[model samples]
Target: MISKKYLIVIVGPTAIGKTSKAIEVAQNYNCEILSCDSRQFYKEMSIGTAVPSKEELSAVKHHFIHNKSIGDKYTVGDFERDAIQKLDLLYATSDFAVMVGGSGLYVEAVLFGMDEFPEIDPSIRVEIQNNYQNLGITYLQENLQKLDADQFEVIEKGNPQRLMRALEVCLQTGKPYSSFLTKNTKKRNFIPIIIGLEADRSLIYERINRRVDIMIEDGLLAEVKSLQNFKEINALQTVGYKELFAFLTDEYSWDFAVETIKRNTRRYAKRQLTWFKKNEYTKWFNYNESSKTIFDYIDSKKTETEI
Candidate 1:
């Protein structure tokens, strides 16, 4: 019998040390790193997105990091197709590959296929975007809450793009957006061993706060400033950039913007944990776990499954 290939998924909230662990494991297994972090895909938003450092990128080969221009239109569906193709190619030369990221939806897209939605009128999306731009996220948020309370509760409400997408889906389908979510899992050639890294809530908040400080120290402000012209882009609708952009627009003071970034990131981390926790297949470990311990667990899992 042919041996099964393995896909080691390193998942956790932001700033929980998933990157370093991924590198160490990939180095040991001689496999490549495939990042599923939705923010890291853009080339223009490094500091805010927290792309891996030069030394870490050099330590192991990585894919999907800084691979797209912010001006390009990319979706979770696009990433799902691209990632599967890459994994197919990687499996040609190696039996193991590593994927690490904090984007729960993107990670799920690669694992279980995205739900198929009916092709609605293009004007519906345009109308949603116009409402978001003219009336603000509150308009979309209130609408989504009224239309699909369940999806509104789970989705990242701070993300205008997500809010708008859900609203559009609800209106276009004349049904709750949550109604489209399917529980079916897609079959894949590779077996996934999901590893989750976590810390206590207090510690996780502390790390998030410190990471935001480091991002400011590393010139996240300047990076956001450069992308100010592209603020309308969906990729810039995230935590770090949005808060800083508010500062740039004089919506808040510099210090207040930074504080908001920290607070929003903490919320995002919480949401990430909630999403990953739903996956019972994930084996949880402390964020500071030694790479060897994780490697051994992966080895044991591979043995158990392969036998």
Candidate 2:
């Protein structure tokens, strides 16, 4: 049975104002926040990660933001372990805690312990990375299409990381990566109230474009430049930094790079939505709705159930 103690999770695709809304909830319940944003782990990536605003940080205690160096090799497994530990401490001090982000894998890492895949040889990873560098991400996409046509329909072709991982497993075991998704969900003790914030597709795209512009005004370019020395860092392999890195490396004009950031951000948000929509447990809310309006729906659900 789920614990009666509350663990609120505010989630959605990127730019859905989850951080701000989480702060509001924390203030209301006098609880702390455990961030699940995979990117915000890096101390050096404030603007690019769209981390909590200063005011929001000041409003409530937040754990796991800006706590790791860019070079640190962290994984969802690590996050799951650390978050559970933090939750234990937080639960000791308060009856509730808010966890929030758009990271589907990271969120699942906490709520459901990630299934451990057999460790692939390091050479397998190196081989796949080399192939991606030589033949491009399209090569991996084509491979996935051939291996698992159904998965190819939903997978993003632009993300080399996912493509390479799938390709690596195929090359190593001659099996589709999707086939290895065989683990059952691990039970959790805490009560998770998942709240997803969403908007119309066009509205989400507009918000992403506007957010990219605001990120520019907030010094994303300078932030990227300062981290140029660490361009090869895995943390810097993200969308914003990679786009801006192209400009810094003279591969693209700054204008084109900025446009690419907006375009890629929109695609990322779409992928996030697709990933989150898979879970039947989430209750989605429109960003246009007032907090009271959304909370009323949640309250009604709670009253209808024993929760």
Candidate 3:
């Protein structure tokens, strides 16, 4: 008989030390790490996305970091499929695998699976795309807000692709996009031990500001400059890159752009905290908590579940 496999998921807001904690756990279990952070998947986005350091990567066998290009059309669905396959291969050699990221949607996709929406009409998508091209993101945002305010509250408002998809679903089915999100979750093979690291809101913001400053000092502007021609790509439409792109185009002053990146990163961290807190099963810890405490909690949970 096949032995049961366990997936240890480390989740938290940005700059919260989830990566280091995940590495510690992976080392303890002697297993590989699977990255679920969507932004860190691109090879071109290193400093701004806060991809793990070379030392961290060398400490553990990691999969999915810097595996794709910014130009690739990858989605949460694609990650879910690829992550599960990687987990299956890991479980064949070891029973425990560590998955880490701040991307709540990607984590939930791997844990509970994605919500299924009906096939959209081609014309609906085309119309939304055309309207987005001509009228800009505000048009899509306004439409989604009118159709599904709940989804509007949760989605990345600046991401035209997400806005367009939500608007397409709302228009195609004549119902709120969020209504289709209620389908029963798909089952998975391994049991997940979800862990969350949190800190005071003020500390979280401070860390985000410091991290952004470090990114700028570490040549984030040069990285953004290298990808300036691809600034319009969906992958580059993120907090750090977008703000710096505006600066490069004379749309924002240098100080203003840097401040905007810090402010936006803080907001993103708040959203991440809100998303992770909704999962009651997650055992929350202080950002500075020791790895041994976390390991003890995991072992206790494992014992209880196996009984």
Candidate 4:
């Protein structure tokens, strides 16, 4: 008989200390951490994306960070496939591996597996992309809402990729994207213990604001300026870059872009909580709590096992 493999997932909103705590747990379990963050994938984006520093990386082995380039195209579907493959190899070495990130969908994509979504037509996507560039996100968002209200409500109307995805589904399947989201969770061979960190809403906002300030101080503007040519890339449309892009284009005063980053990050964290709170599998802990307290809570729920 074969023994089952178990994975520990440390999940939380950004700037909540998931990486440091996850490193501690992984070291204790004698294994590496599997990062689910999408932004941290690009090697060019270190300071802005908060890719682990050399000192931090030297402390514990981490997988999937700085593994891809923003210039290279990758999708959530690709992430799901690649992560499963990586986890298989890691599981062969250790029964328990820590997977940590704030990317809710990417994290869920690996643990439960996504539904079989329909493929989109290339022309339809190109058309939508062209319209987004010409008409703006608000215009595209209006169209998506008219096509699929359910998915539109869930998506960040400002996000081009999400709007494009919803429109792609509607155009290809002639059905609403949300209708297909009935999420027949494809079963996986491993069991995951999910740990979520939270804090007072005000405190979380403060941390996010502080992080944005720190990034600016750490040369995030220079990093974004280097990628100025790639501003239209889907990955560059993310929170940090979008804010800086406004500054680069002279649409915002420097102070305004910095302020928007903090504002948007707070809203992003709120949406993250909304997404994860629905999952009953997650056990929440305060972000500022002692490590011993967190481990005690997690240990009570976890069973000791040997690979």
Please name the candidate that would achieve the greatest lDDT relative to the true structure. Answer: 1
Clashing residue pairs, backbone N/CA/C < 3 A, model 2:
none
Tens digits of lDDT, candidate 1, 1-307 = 8968999999999999999999999999999999999999999989988899999999999999999999999998899999999999999999999999998888988888788877868999999888888998799889999999877766888998888788888999889987876466789899999999999999999999999999999999999999999998898989999999999999999999999999989988988998899899999999998888998999999999977
Q: TM-score each candidate.
A: 0.95, 0.91, 0.96, 0.92
- Candidates 1 and 4, the one with greater TM-score: 1
Candidate 2 structure, TM-score to reference = 0.91
Off by over 4 Å in 4: 146-150, 304-307
Colliding residue pairs in candidate 1: none
- In candidate 1, which residue ranges exceed 4 Å CA deviation? none
lDDT of each: 0.92, 0.83, 0.91, 0.83
State the number of backbone clashes in model 2.
Answer: 0
Error of 3 at 68 (Å): 0.7
Candidate 4, residues 130-209: lDDT per residue as tens digits? 98889888777888889898566556555788788888888889888877763778777687888999999988998999
- For residue 195, give model 3's deviation from the true position in Å: 0.3
Kindly list the per-residue Cα lDDT of model 3 for residues 54-89, writing each as its tens digit.
Answer: 999999989999999999999888998999889888
Residue 127, model 2: lDDT of 80
Candidate 2's C-alpha runs over 4 A off are 1-3, 148-159, 300-307
